[model samples]
Target: MRRDELLDAAEGLLCDQGSAALTLAAVADRAGVSKGGLLYHYGSKEALIKGMVERLIEDFDELVAAQPGETYTERYVGATMAAVRSGRLRRWAVVTSASGNLFLLAPLREAMTRWHREGLSEEPDPLASQIARLACEGLWDVASHDPGLNSEDDLQALEARLRALLASTA
Candidate 1:
């Protein structure tokens, strides 16, 4: 619970105040923990960022696991849509964290590679699954930068189209 609170504090800083404000002292202050406590969990800024990435991936994985779908592709698409709708902080972290440190991306890269591999493994048509997966990721990128670009209806339509495309190939 304390760990999660620290992570939440860190993300709050990242999302609300930008990456510059995400210092260990700031996170410790925001989390109402001592700097020592923060360090006990995350020894450095890089470690904290890596923890944040791991948490984000865990959160997304849980969402994907909980989703109801006939196939991994469907669950993945649903999870991607759900994430795009509610993952502004995550998107921001992914977009902004890399600039601070390239090493921060190693975990993200590994996770994405694994997800891409697993997301298409069960599909009848790997090409269609790949396209849908890429489209979903692209949609996430666009929505992260400009949420206003797609209305609720637009998102629903896009999901439906992607689902249809997946179903067609299935």
Candidate 2:
């Protein structure tokens, strides 16, 4: 299997067991590869973490690019909402914890900033986007950490409402 497949498996393991369960030996075992084989692909734990971050960023970039051509506000809202709805944010939290590297988020933050600056053609409403983004992020964080925050129906309704807000603003 490819390195990404290994990382994906590792991320799943992280979700299942948290940081305590994400040793390289564990990843290799889960991936059905020997420790030496895993080491061959990733010389060290740091290298493996870095590769996971790179893979995550690359996948995020692709997701952003896959959206239909629309206004900056629309695109951003759609992308962000897709992230929330798909439960990717929760999965990402698992990956983040396993990697134990905050720097991994830098590329994502930079990409978002660039998308905001270049995509919004009108009078840039930085505050609005920031608020919306934060709200969505809050929803994801809460959903990931607190299962009682919203029922499935409640979350779907909230997502619809958020999408409407984004559409109207866009």
Candidate 3:
């Protein structure tokens, strides 16, 4: 299969079964590709996961880059809300939890750190960003693990509140 097709299969596997079921062989089967083909694209499971993380980071960066003249706070809040709306971030969070893989945290942390640093003229205080990030993450965590909290209206309200909070920081 094609490279994009392989990654798409991997992402679907990750979303449906979490990271525990994301074996290269399984991904290959899901993508209808040979094991060797999967290996050719991603030499190992670690590499595959790393690539996913990288893709997520790149996606976020592209979102940020797309808004040329927006304030840092606006870009940050917009990118985060967009992620929530898309649901990929929530799926990635679940996959990370299922895998117990610390490596996946690095890129996210780096992105947040850079945003915190460049987003302000002061001493790079990330408290506001962290609070917003954690709030969204909390929403995702609750929604993923608790069926009772799965309300789209509630999520939209939470996203609005997050945007308000992020805006207040600017």
Candidate 4:
């Protein structure tokens, strides 16, 4: 739990305070622990970022699993919307992109690459799967920069339309 708290502090520093402020000392300060204590758990910024990425992956998977769906395609679509709406995806995008650390960035890419190959669909409707996945990815991009660009009503309307389209094809 202490490790998680420190990581949460680091994530806050990255998402709210900007990646530039996400230092070992800053995380220690934010977490209210000694710098040495932070070091004892994380060893360095790279390790912290790695942990964040791992935790992010786990959170995403868990959330996706909780959504109602019988197949990967349906759950993935629902998970994408849930992730975007929850601001989890946005926070992750900002932290990783702005972190400017390749070592921290590399594993995220690698993990996603593996998940993509394994988790996504190669189904009867390849085009539908691709379009749905791509649209969700675009939404993640939009939500990351300026979430206020779309209101709650607008997002719900859009989600309804997308789900309807998916249902029609089913």
Candidate 5:
């Protein structure tokens, strides 16, 4: 709980202020914890950013788990749509941009790689499924910055289209 609180503070700092302002002292102050207390949870800025990345992954996983879908592609689409609707993906874009550290993005990359593998395994038409996944992911990234594209109706339509593609391939 304390860890999450600290991470919450870090995320708030990242969102409210740019990465340049995300100092340990700033997070400690923002979290209402002593610097030592913050240190106890996260030793460095890198660790805190890493924690934020992990939290994002967990958030996405929860969305995926809650989605009712028969295949990984379906679940992925559902989760991405949820992320866009909830503005979580937009916040993630801010977090990733603020960090400016490729090393920190490794965990995100690894999770995506794993998800791609799982998505491929569940679909008989791997090419279609892969295309759907890529397209969905592309939309997810783009929607974070484009409100018109992220609207509920638009996202629903996009999901339907992706599902249709998958269905056609199957």
Candidate 6:
């Protein structure tokens, strides 16, 4: 869809140039759409961000839907592992870091609040599940943004350890 294309272009811009460089003109140029078209789809950066958040929720939902596990906790672990491997969430770094001062981020905050509530509802051991999620998320973020932070062997070992931790909890 044109909307998805525009959001993808905007995300690419944020990843490559940081949020400071994201402008309507840049997004239009990157998306190969006219500025008017861009405006027609998303009136402002805030709306675009909301779109991205919605896209994220959809992507995660797809992962859950495709999960092989019958229980929510098992599926959560599977989806979390898949997300780390699939590279589907790296631009979230940009979203968090986007325009420290200018962007209101209220919608983003609300969306995530609701997602957290709904997404993790069935986990019995919240602390353990949260620990696993945090560890996987931290590793994925670091691996995506700064590969130099850990050698490939180190990363493999850390992943093995994380898996063990998850298995123990599960």
Index of the highest-lDDT prediction: 5
The runs of at least 3 residues in candidate 2 whose Cα sits more than 4 Å from the true structure, single-residue gaps closed, are 101-124
In model 4, residue pairs whose N, Cα or C atoms come closer than 3 Å (at least 3 residues apart or on different chains), thus clashing, are none
Tens digits of per-residue lDDT for model 3 on 96-142? 55445787567767876776566565423357767765565565556
lDDT of each: 0.81, 0.69, 0.69, 0.76, 0.84, 0.70
- For residues 35-124, could you state the per-residue lDDT of candidate 6 as single tens digits? 999999999877777777667667777886787754454555567667656666576677667646444556556744654455465665
Task: Give lDDT tens digits, candidate 5, residues 1-170.
Answer: 99989988887887788788889999999999999999898889888888889888888888888998778888888888877777787668767876778999999999898878885865869889889889978987787677465557777888899889888877
**Each prediction's TM-score versus the true structure:** 0.92, 0.77, 0.73, 0.89, 0.92, 0.73
- Superposition error at 147 for model 5 (Å): 3.6
State the local distance difference test value for candidate 5: 0.84
Q: What is candidate 1's CA lDDT for residue 69?
A: 89
Per-model tally of clashing residue pairs: 0, 0, 0, 0, 0, 0
Model 5 stretches astray by more than 4 angstroms: none
Model 1 accuracy (lDDT, Cα)? 0.81
Candidate 4 residues 22-130, lDDT tens each?
Answer: 7899999999999999999999888888888888888877876888865555677788778877778666875676557787778778856654554445444556656
- For candidate 2, the per-residue lDDT at 41 reads 90
lDDT of 2: 0.69
Query: Candidate 1 on 1-170: residue-level lDDT in tens?
Result: 88889988888877777877878999999999999999999999888888888777888789889888888888888998888778653645443463467688777788788778894766889999999889988987778777778888998999999999988988
Query: C-alpha displacement of 114 in model 5, angstroms?
Result: 0.9
Q: For candidate 2, lDDT tens digit of each residue in 63-109?
A: 66776645555455566656766777766677666654667556656
Candidate 5 accuracy as TM-score = 0.92
Worst 10 residues of 2 by lDDT: 118-127
